[model samples]
Target: MKPTEQIESTLDHVNMYSTPSDLKITDIRFTDIYGAPMHCSLMKIYTNSELVGFGEVRDAASKTYALMVKDRILGENPCNIDKIFRRIKQFGWHGRQSGGVCGIEVALWDIAGKAYGIPVYQMLGGKFRDKIRMYCDTDIDPHLSGVEAGQRVKQRLEKGYTLVKFDLGIGLLADVEGALCAPLGFLDQMKAYPPEVLFHSRATDEASRALRNKVYDLHNIAHPFTGIRITEKGLDYLEQYAAEVRSAVGYHVPLAIDHIGHIGVEDCIKLAQRLDKYTFAWLEDLVPWQYTDQYVHISRACQTPICTGEDIYLKENFLPLLQSRGVSVIHPDILTCGGILECKKIGDLAQDYEVAMAIHMAESPIACMAAVHTAAATENFLALEFHSEDVPWWSDLVCGLPHPIVQQGYIAVPDTPGLGIKALNDDVIAEHIHPGIPGQWEATEAWNNEWSHDRLWS
Candidate 1:
């Protein structure tokens, strides 16, 4: 073929199929992935070109977060991701409220990488490590026998996991009566709902059944609100629970603890003191991450390392915690921590304070892989979480990998373009869409229009 004909043929193909460069934010659609009970929706940005960028909303947040950003980036080039992020970043708020902006950011990076033909990490300044270490979020079965707990520990060690986390909350004492204080009316409110109720804790059947008999917002009810206190007997039983698990799992491995219910700093100090013998990797979210002083108190009071930050948004928000040395370790869920670049910034900020960082992940492989990229790029990263270790199909959600989704407790960062996924298998994804939502990737015509009085200052 002549050069002129070849050039014509290329131009014809560009018109025939939307070229990656001609892309604009033409459409966005979403659906939930049900395994973890997360509102796992995807934001797909359509361009004038053939390519589409995919991003996942953090779990348990509404799809509206992503939908609201549609008006801001509708005609913008996704390749200019930093500019696009700045335009929409103001809309993001603290915690889950920032889900939409964060989700859109992930999709933008996805689109930008696909357009430039590179990996997301390279966009953020290459990587620090070839593979990222991981900690499997395992729970000790309060109902399991001592032998069973030991077996579970052995299983993790055999599987090559160097780090593991477990719950050390009032939920463990749910089966033990007179442990968790509650209002009589609230206790009655809990009795009204059975284990199958929508408000139940999905973490465990034991926690569900145990907490079901407690007050309102069983696990989330704050200590200040409930005025719950552990009696001497209650404290004894709680320590016993910790001791049994520690005896089984042993102290050599890095054992982290979380979901400690909503107990305040004082009681948190006591609980951390009781379990200090076990040397937890960190005592996580003993109270919410918002209270900087409380974190400083908890950090000083407890011999065990203090940690939080799963719901924290952006690096700027994380500054107070790091600057104050509120906690010894920083944990940020990448989904809400300002996507890849912002999360890397959070880690870098923590590094200056000599604080280590960890990633909290609960979404599907899309978000996990995104976390993997950020984790690989950060130096102080301790471990990225694998929240759905029990679900075999979770890894099957995406394809085109050089290795298994995880190997020997580390995920090898792939050297592929655009999040390193060749293509997501649509048929496989359709099979696993959240059961509560009937529509799978349906057209998002309802959110096509936007409304706002969005502005910060003149």
Candidate 2:
């Protein structure tokens, strides 16, 4: 070949971005954004090269979860994703506790994709579909009647969501007489505090923390053990609500139900059977996810599909649910289920059991793109949950994606490398910083030297 042609060929093989082999972790930082419906902590893993990868802790989780492990990964190559994940996975547990290890794992994939100049899905294997179907989660005002709730959900259908979900349970029956039959003070306790304060919020003060802890004690009681039961009056009220919703949206659209409150297994079965006439997409989290036997009983007793696992941490934990066919659909939030690769593994495992997979995403745009990549790669994938469709600035948090990211009930998977995010919208992010913990990607220098023995075995 000619000298000029040889020079051009050598340049073609060069990556102008960064030297992938030499990339090392330099620092980690985070910024918290509140009221994109829930508080979310966004993290960035910096490397020696100019590349930075974005990740998000699960909604309502603390960034301290990620920071505590910074020293374990300092100076390690970000491209060694699985090795780093194995090194750090021992720190993660179920639910929001897994947020740190999972978020960091996502950042590693983002870095790996940028280094290889390919999309995350391509690295996973390849795309199964170019666009992912989205299921809108509509949480209307609790004061609204069932008819009013139906009208609210109908608005989402008009906005182009083919699949939808709504909250329906004993919580809605708090005001109605003879609707619920729990212990003497249990009913009063639920009525005294709003569900947000009782379940969602991170306590800011001593009094609030005590109140939250008290509520948590009551709320954490297992379903069968809670002594909470729905009365026939409650069943009638809930049934009527479902009828109104089904009538408003018509039977054509796929409608799902969630947050049925902490009622017992018998109450769960009763409610599921009562709502069977409405033909819901699924009865989600009817009982705690750990009670596989209860789930099996509920599934066997009802026509509506049973779904759970949004708070489950890893693939191994999901096996019993899948193996027993406890639920028809396995819904896993990528942020809670050990990040992109682990979510894909869960989907693959579910596929082996012949159950479908739907992702449960409630975090920021960073995690959304991580889910998008995973959904595109999984063969048994179903729709993904979009919790912030009503948040105007939700789409403004990230760049390099289409405006109004969810177009007519589906998100077009991006071909761009590294979760398809060019950069975060600093201005938009700054406007929504958490009021209690205000900052924008401040240096986490304290976490740099937090060393300890993390090994699980002798």
Candidate 3:
């Protein structure tokens, strides 16, 4: 068969009205892939044809759109990917229609991959490699001393993680109550030119210097790649901290940092330029993603890689950054960037600009495995971030894997089918969920509302 013909044949005939009359939409379930919620809808297409497919609505509100799409997909052939996406978008009038449709499209693809006996990556194009390099977070408890933090880094390296990220944001140690920005603190902090700089115990320059060295020393232990995450803090010390880190690690090791806690891109560029001596790996999130032009300016000003995108939710968010060549690396949080399929799309887009890709992760193994598969399939993937290195039982959450997920500083991608990791560890879920927060999303009617075509184009 010809390639185009094969592609067309791969999709079974799809019609909105054809149905065996036995199947019905049975259940809907969702998992947070990157802080945003994605869903899986199980449709019993026949008395015996129990075909389960997955879908997503980019965020919580998307569930409402999913509800709408479900009404349309009731008896239709689930094999028509393009038709389904077009219909969903057509009916979904609100702008950002792509998000909801893209998500459901993902689940459809998952179902299609399973139905056709192939991985989603194979259907997209083909796999590039078998394993992905990972950047593991060095987890630290509140108020941990430099010595204590160093121990955490050692443990991650010993476990075979090649790269590590540490948090240095002043907000981590700031006394919110006493902060001038208290109550509406983040806003006030943003207004302050040189934000207040404070550590867990308010360490002085000497103490901060000593502590920085202790943490830096861990870089050369078993593996040398290391990075740090600092909140937007006193700009005065930005250069000093960069110098301190460089002096401690020498020139061979790379030092990177993140600007969480609402810092502006201009300020981030200033800080990055100040820290030029250290040859920092990347200065992250100088400004929120909406400011693409600012990101471009920051990238131009600093030789250090300008990387952002963790907060970016999909391909559209990545295009502005890519088209401008704003950053050398594109960081997409697997959970936020529409899980595996969406993130890979972002990575592939970044690869076009010769930009490296890294992930921002904060979830469990379910999302990690999805990320691994996507990262495995892409050509320009740099590393996947593991944020649970400090959680003692983090690895025990998932079961029945062919090998340990992370090995010798990298994660071995699973060649198996359908996300390749089981989500059935009850004990692990119970142990990890925040005590006050409940698990299993409670259905909220708040998201449902009548839609008027404001954002949508005809």
Best by TM-score: 2
Once fitted onto the true fold, the runs of candidate 1 whose alpha carbons sit more than 4 angstroms away are 1-22, 145-147, 185-220
TM-score of model 2 relative to the true fold? Answer: 0.96
Residue clash pairs of candidate 1: 18-49, 18-50, 24-47, 39-60, 65-100
Superposition error at 120 for model 2 (Å): 0.5
Candidate 3 lDDT by residue in tens digits, 102-164: 445555555555455556666657778777777776545535554555566556666776666
Q: Which candidate should be chosen as best, given lDDT against the real structure?
A: 2
Reference-based TM-score of each model:
0.88, 0.96, 0.67
Q: For model 1, where is the 10-residue window of minimal lDDT?
A: 194-203
lDDT of each: 0.76, 0.90, 0.55
Candidate 1's displacement at residue 277, Å, is: 1.2
The clash count for each model shown is 5, 0, 10
Segments in model 2 whose C-alpha atoms lie over 4 Å from true places: 1-15, 198-205
TM-score of model 3 relative to the true fold? 0.67
Q: Where does model 3 exceed 4 Å of error?
A: 1-26, 30-106, 139-151, 172-255, 430-458
Judge candidate 1 against the unseen true structure and give its global Cα lDDT, from 0 to 1: 0.76
lDDT of 1 at 106: 81
